[model samples]
Target chain A: MGTPLPRDPIADAQRNWERHGWGDVAAPMAAITAIMRTQQILLARIETVLKPFGLTFARYELLALLSFARSGALPMNKASALLQVHPTSVTNAVDRLEKAGLVARSPHPTDGRTTLIELTAEGRTLAKKATAALNSEVFGNSGFGADDVDHLIRVLGTFRRDAGDFTEE
Target chain B: MGTPLPRDPIADAQRNWERHGWGDVAAPMAAITAIMRTQQILLARIETVLKPFGLTFARYELLALLSFARSGALPMNKASALLQVHPTSVTNAVDRLEKAGLVARSPHPTDGRTTLIELTAEGRTLAKKATAALNSEVFGNSGFGADDVDHLIRVLGTFRRDAGDFTEE
Candidate 1:
């Protein structure tokens, strides 16, 4: 949004926090802010790669998840749980995907109370193409070094589990 | 958003990537996905603490930045640069803050064309209250332990630098 500053703003904020006598929480504050900023950067990169496919990260994620599912389908709640997002969000994404003819909602045959979100043939194709683009353009050249990627996966894995995102198998 | 899954969805996504022969990019994919998820969790926590103060994270950041300035005011461009957000976003935040009587805008004293965003008395008090609450509720009990926090700060500092967010001083 502007020219790079000579120093990191988050680090400066950490110093300010310490100077204000909130030293105990300063580090975590900086860490959290950094995560926020980093996510912004990475999401920009990801959305750029996905844009040609007309997918936002959230929608791309749903398509990718469905493409990987056993029958190219998941119950709406199941998709929401696996994505760690609200069910309403899944419903919104499905609505958009359905409108675009990428996916369809159907009554679960045996479990009449449940709805299944199934990828359309077009959805499966788009998912594969969008994924290849992300793999090549974003993930393959993700800013972190290999070791840093490993460290982040481990550290944030613990953080997510602690946040009750999931339990170990 | 639902019951915690039996396994981390990100790790499962990594397996899916690998199975699809995206082996080289899988780790970074998982890492990036984890960061996205972590940001969501942390933002939810931060916003919960901020809501009572009538601030979202973006507004709180601007107010907090103004509160830290030498005279509780900064040129609009300066605030935008420091916040690493688009100037348009700064304009929007300033618009809301001014409407709420939390901040005011004035022509820059020395620069005829520049605008300054200054925290009002109410803004300063609100900022302090918000910071204290965040320090207590979110930062103090941040899910990451001290070591993880340190690691995150370092790793993300490097990532930010690599992304051209800033240069080391």
Candidate 2:
């Protein structure tokens, strides 16, 4: 529906690799490039979707995580681990969410050295609305149908597992 | 070999989604999250490989691009387009590469407004060696064998095309 992509640089790179007698090495190069480029494009689309909600994907993820919690709260360290980002990034996202009145930080009830993050009522409401919007507008419409999406997840899961992203359970 | 990935947060997110009556939306969320996390892992691996060469993936890409050029030179605009990065990113990368003495800029022979970036002899030599190193280490040794690598590129290519990353050729 949008303007078609202008060119395929990965394919061009592959051709160049072949011409240079490096044909065997071309696939990985193109694959990595495509993965990187796709991340960029997806991030941009996500940013555009989240802009109206006054949230970035990082903050949105934090809010969503809290909303999903049984107590609507999580320790900062737990949040960091769950989000698969560094503590500093978690701290930064929490700071932004707090400033936006979507999240609050409190001392963990039992842990002397831990801080817990909770979603405010406003945050909960926003998270719900934002999730719905994203589901319909971005995630649900990601172009790949259910079958392709499943295949992508399966293959990428293997790639991630091999990269030590997570132990296969 | 490295510390195994502890757990897949994306999978947890999917379970949450299913429990929250958003089951249908789980696939895209997991897929995008996997893509993003995989990119992070790949970048980390790439960074490790490039560190010895005093290069980051961004700088390596610029050098590799110039190395692929017939004249070992290309305009900044062209580099930006080919790399699928912004002009400022190109400028920053070029600035760093120039300071590293791996790249040099010269005025375009006929176009006053265009500047050509060329790999110095040192740059060219390093590019060659680095390419070889990456081929044997990170890129070539990426867990996916040739078949899986090709399959990844094909599927991701379709995804990117649908995302409007490039016009179908």
Using TM-score, give the best candidate's number. 1
Number of clashes in model 1? Answer: 0
Q: After superposing candidate 2, which stretches have Cα over 4 Å from the reference?
A: A1-7, B1-6
Residues A95-126, model 1: lDDT tens digits: 99999999999999999889999999999999
Model 2 over residues B18-44: C-alpha lDDT tens digits? 888888888998888888888888888
How many angstroms is residue A41 displaced in model 1 relative to the true structure, after the best TM-score fit?
Answer: 0.2
> Scoring only the second chain, what is candidate 2's TM-score?
0.93
| True contacts recovered per prediction | 0.92, 0.69
- Worst 10-residue lDDT window for candidate 1 chain B reads B1-10
Top-lDDT candidate index: 1
